[model samples]
Target chain A: MEFTLISLLNGVTYGLLLFMLCGGLTLIFSMMGILNFAHASFYMLGAYLAFQLSAWLGFWPAFFLAPPLVGVAGALVERYGLRRAHRHGHVAELLFTFGLSFLAVEMVQLVWGKAVVDYRVPPSLEGTLFTLYSTSFPVYKGFMMLVSVGMLALLAALLAYTRTGLIIKAALSRPDMMQALGHDVPRIFTLVFAGGAALAGLAGVIGGNAFVTEPGMAAAVGPIVFVVVVVGGLGSLLGAFVASLLIGILQTFMVGWDYSIIDVARLFGMQLHSTSALTRLSLTQLAPIMPYLLMVAILIFRPRGLMGARS
Target chain B: MLEVNGLHAFYGKSHVLHGVTLEVGRGEIVSLLGRNGAGRSTALKAIMGLARAEGSVKFKGEEIAGMKPHQIAWRGLGYVPEDRAVFPDLTVRQNLLLGVKDPKAPGRFRLEEMFALFPRLEERALVPGGVLSGGEQQMLTLCRTMMGNPDLVLVDEPTEGLAPLTVAQVAQFLLEIQKRGVSILLVEQKLAIALDISQRLYVLGHGRVVFGGTPAALRENAAVRKEWLEV
Candidate 1:
């Protein structure tokens, strides 16, 4: 029971982090129709920037400044790189961002080296939040949840209540119409891309210390982020949120489970051979690939995703 | 209020509008009559900067030829496309609100005035735009543009695919727009409606102006009608 409770809490914390990354990706995709292959790279850049900033200016200042700096970098990339590539069509734009991801990794390696950076949770949030039986939840996890939930609420309010949010929504489906209605469509695109990058950067600020801050970090978490986006549906924010939590919880629980296919089969009175590798492989071993499996299932069953308007 | 001189537009390699020249006076309802593929819509797009065009497009004495669509719009030019490009996910009220350029700067039309113009829109104010009926969407689009309070409007096929009642309502709306001192450059197919409402008319044929005269002169010119307008 304690295991379930602790895993659920941990899962939620992890899910919110995933949402922080995927939210920006989904927003950028919906607005620009570009899947932004470099989004996770920006997340990595954020972590590295935070690591460097915290070293010089302390954690709080680094936390506040890193995301906007990443946002400015994203804006420059959109205005200079993606905008030019856009003239050649979607393939060129995709290739540009795909190339950008590689460039970001190389740049990070050159500046910060290939080794993991020592980024730690701030002293204030370093201790335990609560004890769940024998397991104590860290205060940093609680802080992460608070920040993620706060970001989500702010984003929702901005989109729902503000004029700029209304305009962004209109531009999502009808950018040309938006232009005709006196909106600078290209500028709006740049702003959205920047905003998306900022969200990812903010995620990295909180997530970097929680996980390992390394050059390989973006690549490690990148594919799972895509899985979350796909399973949530391509452009549906709500779908991404639901899928993030679901995948996070599923993976967490699976990682803790010791049961294998053979054990489950035995329970059903059809024991598999112990010599078979597939039957002997434990659920804990399969946790990493579970999101991909879920994505495949969702694609097969509901191609448009859970709440996606488009297929 | 709008003058297009020697405007040449292209759709990639294929040139669509060839030296199309036209003029719309202040508070005038000028209709561009043509069959499909006559570059009637292209003329509006070029003037609004939605199409790649070269030449002079002057709006209210300012040269707007090389301006972006939003810049042209800010110069007080509005365009309503044939497709009625409503943001499907936004609520009807939100759709109208998006038309306002600056919430602080007062426009010619208000939300209450639009709702009064079409009570159907107010009834479905909270509903998403995708679910609206054809007539309702048309009203919403027209009202949305009006919310910007543009000095001149380029309307493309406003009555296309609409029912007879809706068509009459659209005609009434056009007259109402004219009454508010906004000039209209209308791309219309129905000659009767054009003749009834338009102060002047131009007929487009093969990417050029084939006819330009008053409605009475157009009524008298059967040859121009048979060759360029009647399909």
Candidate 2:
């Protein structure tokens, strides 16, 4: 029971982190119509950048500085790379982004190399927050939760209240109409792309100390973020949030469970196990693949996803 | 005031508009009448810079042959597309707010004045644009363009797929706008409404202007109508 409860909290933390990254991807895709394949690379860059900055200025100042630097980099990529590939249609844009991810990963490897950087949390937030049945939650994670909540509140207000936010929401629904109404839509696209990168960078600042900060971090995190976006539905931020939490919790719980399909078969009194892959499966082995299974099922049953409105 | 001379537009090398020339004086209502595929809409699109074209287009005595759609819109030119482009996810009031070009400074049109003109929009002001009926959507599109306080409007097929009573309402609306000193270059199909509202008429046929005259002259010229406009 203690293991289950601790894992649930862990799952929520992981899910919120995913939401931070996933939210930006949704905004950029809906407004700009490019599935930005290099988003996690930005996250990886954020982690490295923040790690380096933290050594000089401490975590808080690095946290403040890293996202904007990443945002500027994202803007330049949009101006010089993605915008240039736009004339050839969506496929070319995707290829450009795909190429960009490789370049970002390689650049990180060149700068930081293969060793995992020791990105420790600030001593101020390094202690445990609370204890439950001999299990303890770290203050760094608690701080992460607080930041995630703050981000969600900020995002909600921006989308609902501000003029720029209103225009972005309006543009997501009708881009041509936005352009026809005298709005500089390409500029809006650049802003959105930069904003998304900034968000991923923020996530990296916190996630760097939590997870291993290395060149391979983006490759590990990128595919799962794509799953969250897909399962959440295309062009829908709310769906991404819900999907992120659900996948996060499910993956966490799956990792905790010791048995799998073979155990369930034994409960049903079925003893016919003749070297089949399904019978040999363990929940430990199944944890990583559960999100993909859910994605496939959602695609087969409801292709629009839980909260998706795209027709 | 606007003038077009020898305008030729192409949709990826398949010529859609050929040597179309027309003019509109300030506060005047000029109607471009034709059947489908006759390039009546194309003329408006080319002038709005929504289509690729090469020609001499003079507005306010300055040549504006090539400009982006947003640039034209910013320069006091308004275009209401045939599809009635409304942001469906936005509230009707929000839609109206988007039409306000200079949000910092007041313009010729006010929200209350627009509501007074169309009480139905006011009643459904908080509702999302997608839920509005076809006629309401049409009214929203027109009112939205007018919210920019444009000097000239390129209205495409204002009376298409509308009831006769609603058609009269739209015509009244256009006249009201004209009374406000806004020039109109209208693309309309129903010959009766076009004749009733327009100060001048240009009939297009096969990407060319086949006739240009007053409503009375157009009524008398049965050959032009039979060749260019009549189904």
Candidate 3:
């Protein structure tokens, strides 16, 4: 019971982090029709920037400053780089972002070195928030949950209540119509790209210290983020949220279970098992690949994803 | 007022509008009548900056030929596309809200006024635009454009695929729009409705204006209609 409760809390915290990344990625995809392969790279940039800023100015200042800086970088990228590639079509845009991800890694390595950076949670949030039987939940994790949920509420309100939000929702489906309605479509595109990058940066600031701040951190989390977006559905923010939580919880629970396939089969009254590696594989060993399996299943069964409007 | 002189629009290498010339005077409804490929829609697109075009497009005496679509729109031009392009995921109210250019500065049209004009829109204000019936979508599109409070509007095929009763409602809506002092450059296929609503009519043939005159003058000339407008 203790294990389940602790794992559930950890899973939700992790899921919220993934939600931060997925929200921006899905929004960018819906608006620009580009998957933004460099989204995770922006997250990495956020972490490195936060690490540097925190060293000089402390965590609170770094927390506020890093995301906007990343946003400016994103705006510049859209205005100068992505906009030019956009005219050449989707493939060119894809390749441009794909190349950008590599460039970001290289830049980070050149400036910050390939080794891991020491980025720790703030002293205020260093201790445990609560004890669950024998297990303890860290205050930092609670802070992370607070920030993520706060962001989600803020985003929802902005999209639902504001005029800019209405225009963005309209532009998501009909950019041409939006332009005809006196909206500067290109400017909106730049703003959205910047906003998306900023969200990713915020995620990086929070997640980097929670996990590990390193050059390989983006790559490590990148594929799983994509899996969440795909398994949720393209361009559906709610889908991304749900998928993030689902995958996060599933993977966390799987990692906690040490039982092998043969042991499960034995419990089901099928004790005889072969010496094959698949039959003996533990759930903990399979946890890392579980998201991929879910993605594959979703693709085969519901190609449009959990809430995708189109196939 | 809007003016298009010697307008030539192209889709890639294929020229769609060749030297199409037309005008919409202040507080007037001018109809562009033509068959499907006669460039009626392209003329409107060129005027709205939706198509690649070369020539002079003057809006309220300002030369806006090379401007982007949104720039042209800022010059007080509203466009109602042929496809009834409503943001399907957005609520009807949100769709209308998007049309307002400056939310802080009130336009000539109001949300309340739109609801009054089409009570059906008020009934489905909170509903997603995709689920609205075809006539409701058309009404929403028309009202959405009006929310911008444009000085001159380019309305393309607003009555296409609508029921006869809805068709009458659209014609009535156009006249009502004119009553509120908004000039209209209407692109329409239905001859009777266009003849009824328009102050002047321009018949387009093979990307050029073949006839331009009052509705009475068009009624007197059957040859022009047979050559250009008759499908």
Best by DockQ: 1
Model 3 pairs whose backbones collide: none
TM-scores of the candidates, chain A only: 0.98, 0.95, 0.98
Candidate 3 residue-wise lDDT, B21-95, digit = tens: 888999999999989988888888888888899999989899999899998888899999999999998999988
Q: Report every candidate's CA lDDT.
A: 0.93, 0.89, 0.92
Ranking of predictions according to DockQ? 1, 3, 2
| Model 3: per-residue Cα lDDT at residue A299 | 95
Clashes of 1: 0
lDDT of 1 at B157: 93
lDDT, ranked from best to worst:
1, 3, 2
Q: Evaluate every candidate with DockQ and list the scores.
A: 0.92, 0.69, 0.91
**Top TM-score prediction, candidate number:** 1
Clashing pairs in 2: none
Error of 2 at B190 (Å): 0.9
- Cα lDDT of model 3 by residue, A66-152, tens digit: 999999999999999999999999999999999999999999999999899999999988998999898889999999999999998
